[model samples]
Target: MSILIFSLILLVGAYAAGLLGSLTGLGGGVVVIPLLTLVFHVDIRYAIGAALLASIANSSGAATAYIKEGITNVRLGMFLEIATTAGAVGGALIAVFTPVNTIAILFGLVLIFSALMTIRKKNEHAEQTGSKWSYVLKLNSTYPTANGEVAYKLKNIGGGFSIMLLAGVLSGLLGIGSGALKVLAMDGAMRIPFKVSTTTSNFMIGVTAAASAVVYLQRGYIDPGIAFPVVLGVLGGAFTGARLLTIMNPRTLRIIFCIAISFVALEMIYNGFNHQF
Candidate 1:
């Protein structure tokens, strides 16, 4: 394809990726990387770099809206970010020496896990009074609602912090925000409300992505052509998705997202084993 044609096609694809990501709770980077490497024939490293840029763009855009809504737990997000930021830098540095095929396989596996996590039914946990750590760290906070602000408790701080570290490593390695795992850490481990978990995850994603992005830049993996189209398209699509979410059936969208992501993830794993990369 000519440069103009390639750029246009990528822009469209990235937009679709972003829309689906927004609707399904997967970050745009998950879809963006596969499209670039598998369909567009971009190198894995370059695709990762572009995906990281897309992730940062999407995170920043969504976070602004979430923060404005007063649902984001800024103190909790920032404190947990310390773990993710450290892990992201470590993962990014490790990516430099990792084989391309290995990276592709690992990414595919993580995608499969993410897909499964999305489609599964959620179990509600009763609010905990909170562990001593939550009191000491002051991570507990309230969110706005029609009635008014209602306070929430935090729990299992040690476990949640440990999980955040792994989430950060995956974010750096896969060039994604790892939003799902971050939510898992907060909602599942820390016993935070779902709204708080999601908003805080979005709040933290940009910082995690930025940490890894610095390493990717040092490695010279970033391409201006790919990054520009991916970032612009994802931001545009994310905007449209926010509107669609108000009207769409979230469960249906999640199922569709899970299926689509699984298919691409399997392809990535297949190609990796076949030495296509």
Candidate 2:
């Protein structure tokens, strides 16, 4: 009975994650990690490990559909993978050695930062003016929008890549999706439009997750019992969220997401400082 109940919980969590992730572009980790740790009382490290696996699942599951819809640019995603994968490896290595409290504090800070970034208005007409790498990589692309297909030129490709590397590292280290940072890099630094930036980021996240997931698995941080339910729930939720994306008011959603992240961040900080297990 206990096992069955736990499994049910996990499935529900995963579905919720999927729904919320698709809507907010935040991904499963945003929802799964906290629930695992706070509600289930799982260790943060193991929770992160499970989150990494679920992230891969969510990304792979969604990418094909997004690509078919022409929202994901395979070329752009592949190009960015180089930086993100390298960062994931580095971050995972660091995670093995870092103290749990320190990790918690950093995670809290990152959540707060993500919330701030999400609330800001996008700067349209931002100049894609300079950068040698931007030209060589042809980071520019167009995507279908409600307004019609729109073209965007690349700007500061190197800067965006640099940020992705950092995002990947954090993804591995914290076991969170890291989509917020990825979106910021592509949207803010590269000046890609919101939709394009999001799909592309989603497309690239699986590679980042894969880079560290191997290590986590080998370290036995992965608990299949935990991962199975979370993934299932998150995936279901994400699919629903994606369907609603067209009709939903994103600003209202962003505000709610920000509030949730802020609360989790504070909890993490408190736990870290208090040395609470």
Candidate 3:
């Protein structure tokens, strides 16, 4: 294919990836990497590098706006960052030596699990009253609502932090923001409010991605030619998706998102077994 045609095709794919990501709160990296490696035939390492860069762009862009809205727990996010950053660096280093097929298999499994989790119904309104760890760490906070500010309590700090470390490692290894895992840690283990957990996860992922991105850059994995268009396309698409969030039915969007992710997961698993990288 001609260079122009390839660039255009990538631009369109990246935009769709970003749109789905923003709407689902999944981040764009998952879609971006698969499209790059599976469809475009880019090397997995280069696809990872591009996905990492795009993830930073997507998360940081949304995070800035979210911070202004005061939904993010900056203190809690920073506290978790210590573990995530360390894990990301470790995972990135490991990725350099890991076999391509192994990475593909792991990526496929993670996607399948994430899709299954996404489709499972869950209550988002439940909140803890208090916890010893929350008290020590001052994890409790309030957010502004239409009615009034609503306060929330935290629990299971140790478990949350441990899960965050694992999330960080996966993020670095797969070149994704791993927002799903972060949300699971905060909402499932820490008992944080769902909205707060989502915003905080977005706030923290950019920094985690940057840490591993440095490692990928030093390893000569990031290609500017592939990354530039991806950054622009995903960023624009995410912005558009965010705007559409208010107008669209989230439940409908979520159902569509789950179906899309399931398809990608199955394809990735099939490709992994076929040793297609």
Candidate 4:
């Protein structure tokens, strides 16, 4: 394809990815990778590079709105980043040598799991108590509500931290923000409010992607032509999505997240098993 045609295709795909990513905290990379590799016939490594760039843009565009709204727990996100950044560096180094098929299969499985996890009942109002660690670290916080700011607390800090490490590893290996797993860690394991988990995810994904991006750059996976269009499109979409998220129903958000990921997961898995990665 001509450069202009390729760039246009990437821009459209990345825009859709970013919108869904901002709404669900999945990050644009999740969509960008599959669109690049499966539809555009790009190599997985180059796709990863583009996806990482798109994800960082997605995070930056959405995070500002979430932060301004006070829905994002910046303190918690920063605390969790310590683990994710550490794991991302190691995973990026490993991705340099990992097989493409293996990475694709793993990515598909993770998406499936994340989609399944979204089937649960309401979580934002789940009764949770602050764990001792949360108290010590001061990670507990409040978010806006129709009535006022409602407080939430953390649970299973150890479990959440462990899951965050895994999220980071996947982020680096797949060039995804690992926002799905990050949501699971905080929303499910830690008992954080779903809104808080998602917004905090938006805050953290950029930092995590940046950590691994340096490694991808060193390995020459980042292509300027692909990265530029993807980032530009994602930023535009993410900002639009962020505006809608504040008024969106949580249940509706879950449905969108599940449907999007499930479809992509199955397709990715089929292609990976067929040695198409």
lDDT of each: 0.88, 0.80, 0.86, 0.84
State which candidate has the highest TM-score.
1
Better of 3 and 4 by TM-score: 3
Misplaced by over 4 Å in model 1 are 123-126
State TM-scores per candidate: 0.96, 0.91, 0.95, 0.91
Backbone collisions counted per model? 0, 11, 0, 0
lDDT of 4 at 66: 76
Report the C-alpha lDDT of model 4 over 1-277, residue by residue, as the tens digit. Answer: 8999989988888888778766665566787787888788899999899888887777786666678889998889999999999989989999978889888988888877766665665376744578899999999888898889898888899999999999999999999888778988998899987888877987899999999999999889998998888888888877777678677766677587778778888888888889987
Pairs that collide, model 1:
none
Model 4 vs. true fold: TM:
0.91
- Candidate 2 lDDT tens digits, 95-214: 989998888888888878877776777655424464667667766667776777766677778788899999989988998769889989988888877777778888888888999888
Candidate 2 minimal-lDDT segment of 10 residues: 123-132
The residue-by-residue lDDT of candidate 3 on 7-95, one tens digit each, is 88899999998998777766788788888988899998899999999889988888878888899999899999988898899899899
Which pairs clash (backbone N, Cα, C closer than 3 Å) in model 4? none
Give the higher-lDDT candidate: 3 or 4.
3
RMSD in Å for all candidates: 1.3, 2.0, 1.4, 2.3
Worst 10 residues of 3 by lDDT: 119-128
lDDT by residue (tens digit), candidate 1, 1-277: 7989999999999999999888888888888999999998899999999988988888888887888889998999989999999999989988878889988998999898888877766634436598998999998788887778878889999999999999999889889888889988988899887888888898899999999999999889899988888999988888898999888778976887799899999999999988787
